[model samples]
Target: MPLGADHLIHANVVCSDFERSLDFYTRLLGARVIGEVFEFDAGEDFMTILGVTGGARCRAALLTWSDDDTATYLDLLAFADGGGHAARTAKDTGLARLGLRVRDLAAALAWIEEHGVPVVGGPVTLTPMPGRQRHVVTIRDPDGTLLTLMEFPERR
Candidate 1:
């Protein structure tokens, strides 16, 4: 028998500044805020949950790219006492980046450039098969979290 894992709920990104990161996601990726930003103090429950001691607090909100209720969400969270830094490189391992599939890479790039967001990597073409092609680029958020935008050839 195999463990029944259905789907990914959300990936949490610990931001240095919650509002800035939220704004970046909304403005650049068109992520809509699902609800109000809330904060809570972490007691023994959070300590066990996050593997930390007492006195940890968090500010958080869920963001979605679409209006579907079952859609996966981006959980943007920040800690009151957290002073951690982001992963320096994708090779550093855990939660490297969030990859989003877009319909138009050119339009996305244009909007990103117009907003003064630097493109860290290519809009390079990837041709795995004769008819299959993918265009990709990498950009960072306000907290330097890598986001990969990929556009694939439309299917018939």
Candidate 2:
């Protein structure tokens, strides 16, 4: 029999400003720094793999959780020479938008509002996956990147 996967390994995100992204992940999201890599060694390799040019001067950072609770790791990347394209709007595109699971949807929305982030959608119920329930709220970050904060009280 095939073995069942325990957890997700990692997720990669390309950012325009490496420092700002790192700060957002570390400060706002509470992610800890696991490792960092300079450009000269793995920059060219990454650019080639990503099908991009002039990214040899970029920087990469690997971040992990504080505990081994079987959570997905995040790879924060910045391209010094060749910045990637900006994130598309949710109305016009179907792309990646970071999802954060919070305990209280209303409290989280309040905190996010106080922080000056604009809320796109309401604290509404979504039944996209049958038999699964998710209370979600959408917001836009400083870079206009859409993010969803979900509360899974039913799951708990």
Candidate 3:
């Protein structure tokens, strides 16, 4: 029998600044904090799971797009000694971006601009099939993680 998959649990984002990322995702992206933020030092099991060496401390919080208990959330993490950043681009070999579906692309763009976040790419339209139109744009969070906001105007 094939292994069945139900749904995604969450996506992990290692942040350069925990507070800044928390504010950006919550205030600008409309995600609400699922619980209080917590901090902990990496234990043996944690280090092994994350594939890291040496001692490390981290702070984390869960953010959800809605109030639904089963909704996918963002696992925002910040390491105390995380060192330098690489600056991810769309062409990066690993995970490059996260896609968010918005109700109105125009309104979302306007709100993001009003909050002083610049659009890094596209307000381009995609017609994947007949009568199916999508508008998408790219923006970066405080930690330079690209988020692709897409709007599907209609269902065909």
> In TM-score terms, which candidate is top?
3
| Model 3 / residue 119 / CA error / Å | 0.8
Lowest lDDT 10-residue stretch of candidate 3: 147-156
Candidate 2 lDDT by residue in tens digits, 58-81: 577777655663457777766556
Enumerate residue pairs that collide in model 1.
none
- Write down the TM-score of every candidate: 0.90, 0.74, 0.91
Compared with the true structure, all predictions reach lDDT values of 0.85, 0.71, 0.90
Question: How much is the lDDT of residue 22 in candidate 3?
Answer: 90
lDDT of 1: 0.85
Residue pairs of candidate 3 with colliding backbone atoms = none
Better of 2 and 3 by TM-score: 3
Candidate 2 residue 81 Cα shift, in angstroms, is 1.6
